[model samples]
Target: MSMDLWEYQQDEVMSEYYQELCLSEFQERAIDEFTAERLSSYYVENSNLLVDSFRALEEAQKVSSLSPTSGLIMAAISIEIALKIGLLKPIVFGFVHSEAVAESISNAVVKQTGIDRFKTLLVTLLKEISHVDIVTYKRSGTKLSLWDERGEVQKRRNMISHKGSLSSSQDCQFAIDVAEAILNELLPDVLTSLNLHLQNKVIVE
Candidate 1:
């Protein structure tokens, strides 16, 4: 199929899936290795924060007068962590999708693939985001569509933050699962087009 037609079909299918799941989904999981490394670092950092908060909660439980306030604070922190974790899925998705599109374009032009070329694609992706007008960025360029999706995810994050809106643990899990589905569907096509292998490697900082 033509790129435009394929993208349209992707949108249609993803939209239907999102409606059924009540979650946003991406087309691929083709994140650059560097981006994955950064995200892994972020997860580590957040895990530390979670550990500290849990420790504080444990200490507070031992104190009678401060227990109520401590419990409330811990609950709020837990919710924040959950939302951040939820947000991470889409943020990672955006980076991967953006990088994959750029890589596919560059590989087609050069008829060869290299890690450096992929990194160049990543730099280009970041530059596009940096130079665009904030208000119009979502519609301006090839990778800009990811920014639109990012905005939607941010809105959900806001609801989670201000309204305590995520209904249950299942809701949060669904968000992550949708993210994975989006990546899984899109990444393989991009990799196949580029004649590149998607290896399963642990991305560390």
Candidate 2:
């Protein structure tokens, strides 16, 4: 059917209005996604958790002989605990939903049952805090390389735990050092908030 001049003009106006409407909708969605919520301070109330982890690492350094193996494993665990503290800091300050805690707890249970591919505590903490995968998170200029070195600590800990592998004093010391480096590197804010004065402590303890 042929359209008169006015009919054609009305159709053109309607098409232009439709395009503008779509553009407005797109801009609104973009703005909503681009906006970021202010992150809450996490270091105030949960300071002790980090302090206790540091204390445990210090004590681990002092132990001798075969027992140092246990100490080293505990140091690795302390680092993991500190990272968990970091991840939960936002939750403590009401930055994220409380329901996320319940979800994480349930997922931990399922993981323990070997029902699915379980993420390591460190990996889980990294994702929660950085909102990215491990590789991308590491690219953000974190100095300690926890993604690579912590896995070594875990493997050594596992060997000692599962196969009764002999651990040297050097191995224990390395674990403690790596844990300390990571703590000082990644969680400086959390550490400063704890007022633990960790930098002054002796490395060998």
Highest TM-score scorer: 2
RMSD of each: 19.0, 18.6
Residue 76 lDDT in model 2?
Answer: 75
Q: Across residues 26-128, which tens digit of lDDT does each residue of candidate 2 receive?
A: 2234323221222222334333446666777877776635587777777877666554444333322232234464334322332221111223332343344
Model 1, clash count? 4
Q: Give all candidates' CA lDDT scores.
A: 0.35, 0.49
Error of 1 at 53 (Å): 23
lDDT of 2: 0.49
Off by over 4 Å in 2: 1-39, 64-66, 88-95, 98-144, 189-205
**Model 1 misplacement above 4 A:** 1-153, 201-205
Best by lDDT: 2
Tens-digit per-residue lDDT, 100-166, candidate 1 = 6533332232222112223333334333332322223332233534334334434554566677764
lDDT of 2 at 110: 26
